[model samples]
Target: MNARNAIDMTAPVQAPRDAAPASTWHSQMPDDKAMLRAAAELTRDIAVARPGIYWPDMLASAFVGYAALAGAILVSHPVAAVLLGLLSALALYRALLFIHELTHIHKDALPGFRMGWNLLVGIPMLIPSFMYEGVHTQHHARTRYGTVEDPEYLPLALMKPWSLPVFALTAILLPVALLVRSAVLVPLGAVIPPLRTLVWERASALAINPQYRRRRPEGDFARMVFWQEVGCSVWAIAVLAASFAWGWCPLLIALCVVSLTAFLNQVRTLVAHLWENDGEAMTVTAQYLDSVNVPPPARFSGLWAPVGLRYHALHHLLPSLPYHSLSEAHRRISQHLGEASTYRKASYPGLAPLLMRLARSTMTAR
Candidate 1:
């Protein structure tokens, strides 16, 4: 999706004075199908036509070595432990970037490269990269329809004006949220039957559906999730074993699990679309609901926002483009989309502001 010039702040910027902002133009819903079709033209190589050891890839290699060193430092120096926590946070962020792709394409295009990459990247991040592919694939396929399952997205209406209070409460209770992610969500992905059932159900629904059968199911993003998770799980277990032997269980645990959740990945996703007209056909995860491009942490977070994730609208509109080319597509989309695009910038952010905007911004909805 191309981006547009910043809203003319100098202009009155009156949202149609007489008409309801709900006018269909506010629906400015890009012809998602058309965007997907254009993207299809470029999906031929989801990764680079030739994957080279670029700077990010090299940084990825350095990270693994850093993790190994982190284990030792965590026991020897408390400051090192905290610093490792930050580093782990950074690594987990990158892991999610791997997931963005895992959500987009299967890893079989270049198995040798993919397998090694997944093992190297997924393990330290504790993502179970392989398993994520399958589950996340299903997520993209049935996002809003049946997989109404992923609800970092609760209807703001349900919360009412109280939503603000609730969001405030949540900000303080964030540790609880992180606890749920680590103790519950991640573990369930590893051990529970019900969670696996969710994955299978999502997969089955997509398998039988027409629109979803777009890319081959096996090679779909689901597989990418599955393998990445697989690798992450293995690495996590290994980290535990090694740490236990080194008598650094607590430290290693913090590095592998606690810090992973602290990466704020879930926040990035949840706030992206937390409060929208949940009644309308939502894009599966509220993650697709509302998002902005060129957010605050662009340069620092670029590696973590794979496939032009900062270009959320574009990424959602055209998931097939190689991560590198998303910028070009986003540029084009901007010119065509103009102000039809929403959230001209990252004005209001975090769950609370987003919820407030959702309520006020209902100025319009499709």
Candidate 2:
């Protein structure tokens, strides 16, 4: 769900006609207090995370994903394999996105849901919950939301046009990169103390900011990271050994499926924000405006931005609102605030326009 830091800036760039002046890049927008009050008072009832929804949805998604992956690998027909692979990618993508929820929800909200998720999806996917737990919360911090300290934010709208494609495409390599990190670099780092420090700081978090170095995990988090690291290392080594001992076709197919999933997530991340912030500490209203919401009638927003992410702008408003409750929450606030409200400004019709707008913004970046 985080943007990848890959950009090819060698090409000649031209500024678009609508480009804003450099002096206006920092958000000076005042917080909309009425909208903020409505958001809090309207959604207080649905703020709690429901375990029933979380457990069933995650279990089903993982089941369907693995089943479809098995079908993709076993089916000899090229067309059938491609179709099944795509299905696997989408289902797993949804399952994997529960990691985002894990970060926001209280530790006691769902009891053992965190450990269950790791056993089922996180460790198996080589993306244990530790990578996101401490990291994503910082992105939601009041003073750090769009600043350089925010691991998930990047000023893509201020970059060269070519950077977008490169940023998106590079995510295809993430699965393989994670495999290398766990199977190769991690094991090596276990002996070399300096290398261990370097890997933990630089490669541990799922962050977009190239300069965002992670601090060492501590207490319970450190313990969790230790176990997750062991799990990933063992899993990765076993996978590589099996692939080598047998033919590499199955592993290759699995990697390709995961790569497709990562690519889809990267594309989703691209449109999740307006990406106009230039590292300034934004106000809450500014953060919400900078975020996006592809509300109903878009139809396919659910497919790309699952687990309440389509209401990302609303999420910035109420970070603890459970995924299943976002729609009802959105409706209450929207009707209360009316069409001309600042809340309405964050809602977009669909993905195409968002993409076109981002592309245009990049074209105008100086």
Candidate 3:
């Protein structure tokens, strides 16, 4: 059965943190050559991937997403169109896994063939392979407090009763944020050169401190961020060209589909880190326990958790493994870590109700 089918994403997820830390939670997932072992295991199992050029799965899904968006625009039945668009959005999230693979693996090592193929895979997802690679690398190196380690989680103190209103408002506002982002913000940010330059400068400064600019220009990082945008810009241009010569519907459909996928991606990211508190948890596990992932032997899990994010705790423990092999790596290690691995199967719909449940729980609890 498809792992996605195994998941009941729509039903209620049990309150995530109600169970006290796993019997083994006190023992952190091992980090001793874990990344190395993970890589070897994953490579032995998952297909030897071909980057830059279409990853067979990600490519097939990208076409599905694009076709669905087109259908959403032209198809007569609104409901079927919306369903297809939703499925496509989910498929696009999986496409992000190929991008994650590029971030983790060195493209040159694989096939002496197309290095550009690695970069090409990242564009449609709006992620710069280089920038994200660096950021995510640092994130894995130290998933804790202060400076650049954290993967952008809200501060734990953020869940005060007073803050409840804020999380609720933000949760409600998410869908609207997607529309504004894809339709207005993303498109405008691309067309306006001044805005684009400002963003680039700011990102460069962040990637490497300005004081160290002379030391590190982030050739890879900047290129990653740049081409990622370039891809989005190209996508935007295509939509506009079609809309102008034809009609607005196609463009609107494209924006809706892309944004919907991106929004779901964000939900997965935030929740992965949402429940943990700052001090000890940050120091030890970094973002591993805070992150959620579906383990492999179940690749289909990517539909709900992009980039093998479901196997996140395992990845954090073993960062060097290429994404394609995360599943097997996770499965092998999971026996050792057990629930300390944070391998839950809550459906996304169930996840929402669970999040709402936690909104009322102890700030430190899940």
Q: Against the correct fold, how does model 2 do in TM-score?
A: 0.94
Which of the predicted structures, 1 or 3, would earn the higher lDDT when compared with the native? 3
lDDT of 1 by residue, 1-366 (tens): 011123332122234322433223223433344444544554444435235533365357447545744563556776776666566655555544554564464354434654554555545544334434444444344334222443223444334554434443443333333334434455575578766555444432212222342222465555655555455445555655676787775544454544444334544453443244343444321233344455442353354343356566455545545566666665554455454433232222223343345555333332
Q: Report the C-alpha displacement of residue 265, candidate 1, in angstroms.
A: 0.4
Model 2 root mean square deviation, Cα atoms: 5.4
Every model's TM-score: 0.59, 0.94, 0.64
Q: State the C-alpha lDDT per candidate.
A: 0.44, 0.89, 0.49
In order of listing, the candidates' clash counts read 31, 0, 12
Residue-level lDDT of model 2, residues 1-366, one tens digit each, is 312112211111113212545435345567899999999999999999999999999999999999999999999999999999999999999999999999999999999999999999999999999999999999999999878899998999889999999999999999999999999999999999999999999999999899899998889889989999999999999999999999899999999999999998999999999888887887898788778888898778999999999999999999999999999999999999987787887887777777878888788778
By summed lDDT, the worst window of 10 consecutive residues in model 3 runs over: 206-215
Please state every model's RMSD to the true fold in angstroms: 7.8, 5.4, 7.7
Weakest ten-residue segment in model 1 by summed lDDT: 1-10
State residue 211's C-alpha deviation in candidate 2, in Å.
0.7
lDDT of 3 by residue, 26-89 (tens): 2343433543454345446554444543455656766676676667777889898889888777
Ranking by TM-score: 2, 3, 1
